[model samples]
Target: MTALALSHPAVALLLPLALLPLLRTSATPQAYPSLEPLGGDPLSAVFSWLLRLAGTVAIAALILGIGGLHLKGQTITKTGEGAHIVLLIDRSSSMDNNFAGRAPAGGEESKSAAARRLIKDFILAREHDLVGVAAFSTSPMHVLPLTDHKPALLAAVDAMDRPGLAFTNVGRGLALSLDIHERDTSAAARAILLVSDGAAVIDRKVQETLRAAFAKRKMNLYWLFLRTAGTRGISEAPPEGEPDTPQAFPERHLDLFFKTLGTNYKAFEAENSAAVAEAIAEISKLERNPITYVENTPRSDLTGYAYGLALLCMLLLALAKAAEVRIPRGSPA
Candidate 1:
């Protein structure tokens, strides 16, 4: 079943041109007494019908040639695999300093710089994933929306390569990060990657909101904590012969809170750039979910074929009319 589509459908308004021969009468001069001789001649009747058929066919082909008829089709296909990932970064003032508690020198990258570099690599590594960026300091900033456009996501990450504010509003940032996927209707997997070194106490209401958001979807939560030298972090261990001391560091307590959020959650404490790269590598492994995409084929033109057919029919008409015979009227014996 093929469908014909016209590029300029309005051109069909000239369809009445094909019926011109049918609407008008054409008279042929004939020598006859009382017009009875030609009416009874079988050969004359056949010639008249043949002439009309040829004229009608020629008119139809010409009209269609001008009208422009074509067939168009579209297809949607799915291929490869990917997920929707949101990078939630912390931009507190302390993030500007290197993990060694000193300003970065000799081109040494700071914690935030390391995270940004690694996150950019993570986004580029995925082939079809929709990646977004969100960073927070004293407040939440929506840097980018979820999208499969890699350059825009990478550029948005690079834009945050400046100084940070004083506060670290983790709760609000996390809450805003959840909103990135709230209205998603795609089948792609969802995940939030948090890159931060310090932790701030979240308000009770904010905590409740985050908890509800986590439970509302099947989302993966990964925290890539930048652990400065000689500072306690989310993975703080107890002394020998003692139980685990999760409360020893504020980040550890935050880790505990995330553990209770009823989602697939994991925390990695990276002490250096190498560790940061490793953490992102692990994340790349987890983002192997299958994704789908659509490809469109270019439209093909059919007007040329219509015009050729019209020309061929007109040519045949010319040959048929040339074969017609006529006798001299006054020379008959």
Candidate 2:
């Protein structure tokens, strides 16, 4: 089952629910026999059984009290309306490749830098949508959780520092984004926008598992492939393999990988800053589908139940103490 994602407003309202336990009383006092079994010659075992039953009820109450405390700490509720879009960015060492566009000093812009710019523009365009960022290299890393704070999310985008390794794990980033979106049950269509220049080098079994997981959520996967835009001077284009029928871009395996995304997926060839921004904006449009059903917020009034339990437990302990305190005087005849 998919986990529900709680909005900020819902979290704020339920945050206090965690502290209700500390405010209530401990336990109720037991009635002292009006006249202590005076001159009583065995009132029968019936009274003893009655006392045991009362003690059991009190113990149950204590169990209830402990449950109340547990409920408060992990309260989750659904709030706000609209679809959630998570941007899963690849921040492995390959993202640092300085080959998109170069300056006269022989230095070029990195793929991640381009991705950051595109994401910032996209966030500015649609600040209403709840969006998050996850940057991954060898493992998935959350740059920002789902939120409406555009500025903060953008900062997360900016914070995707390139790892020193020379490879990227595309699947890891995708899996993490899906996990986040699944938690937010209010989202209508959980969509992921992944920008990467290379395929994941992880094992095929792992990749298949990741693919199955994504399919289960029916997630919309969008891809923005960044490649060299053919600078007027540099001639070392990553070997095109004897130009097949003179196509604009030769049929690389990357095309097939993206084609697997099918209809919901839109593959955009963005080798420069402007195209990257356009592709992101286009995907944002698709991610804006309205949410149909909003789950009823969990009505956690377990506070009262908790207090009752504590009272019950205290009563039991008190009874036990009283039993220990009773001094036997040979039947008060």
Candidate 3:
């Protein structure tokens, strides 16, 4: 469905049931409904207890009434609703492995294929949102332009089927997304959704350049880290009968860089294709607060109302106490 077709301010339906207590009587009224049976002992403690009970019920009713009113008054208006999204995908050799999730035992879906499956799902689901695609291997490449053209985007995703060891370039990928977003005349919210299996093989200078560019443009960063068990055809073993010590891939350095980037970026760790799609759906709904609301975040003002009701309860208690004092003990007047 198109994002525009989706409901705004998403409704959270709540049913109020506590108001019923307000209509109930303060106590199990004696058949005559009065304290006459207490020997008219106005100072009878039972009368005071009844008054306090009534006050407690009244306060509860007030709280329920206020909650219902707030719910009824809720409003969600679309301010700058049509936003632009950039999808950054990694196409390194590790993306060609079988670790994502064993595709049914006999299936032929490779790792990149599975990731593309997720990309397609996300694209198809976003009917109204403008989207762009950038694929990163040795460097970032703009495979698709920013547009609402679903078919083109899907085709592009399906076409990225390189099966060799390619280095990752996250910084360049992000820079490309920023460039595309700059072209838009009225982008409501410019955001970058990066999907990769950890770090890039780019230099620090390039990474800094991308970061500065994004900071200057005031864009939000969303990172998705697709996990990998390891790449296929990689042999960690030594010659037969030969002793071998474990050696980490040079990519470990790249991993550290991404860890730092992920710290500042909105990150998602996708264990498999299904998770990737789900993450996209969730991230899409994350609404950035309007810049104007930056100073004072809205807060629920139930405290004042609660205090008022509490005071009413205290008043009821006092009245009940006074009535108890006037009544005589054990004698009907």
Q: Write down the lDDT that model 3 would get.
A: 0.60
Q: What overall lDDT goes with each candidate model?
A: 0.78, 0.60, 0.60
Q: What TM-score would candidate 3 get against the native?
A: 0.50
- State which candidate, 1 or 2, has the greater TM-score: 1
Q: List model 2 lDDT by residue over 95-123, tens digit each.
A: 66644443213454677776777678877
Error of 2 at 270 (Å): 0.9
Q: How far is candidate 1 from the true structure (C-alpha RMSD, Å)?
A: 6.3
Task: Please give the lDDT score at residue 113 for candidate 3.
Answer: 75
Write down the RMSD of all candidates, one decimal each. 6.3, 12.1, 17.2
Q: What pairs collide in candidate 1?
A: 81-291
Worst 10 residues of 1 by lDDT: 24-33
Rank order (by lDDT, best first):
1, 2, 3
Show model 2 residue runs off by greater than 4 Å: 1-82, 98-109, 161-164, 230-255, 261-263, 292-333
Candidate 1 TM-score over all chains jointly? 0.67
Q: Total backbone clashes of model 3? A: 14
Candidate 2 scores a C-alpha RMSD against the true structure in Å of 12.1
- For model 1, how does the per-residue alpha-carbon lDDT over 160-209 read when each residue is reduced to its tens digit? 65888999899999988899888567777899999888888877899999
lDDT of 3 by residue, 43-73 (tens): 6466545664666555654554444322222
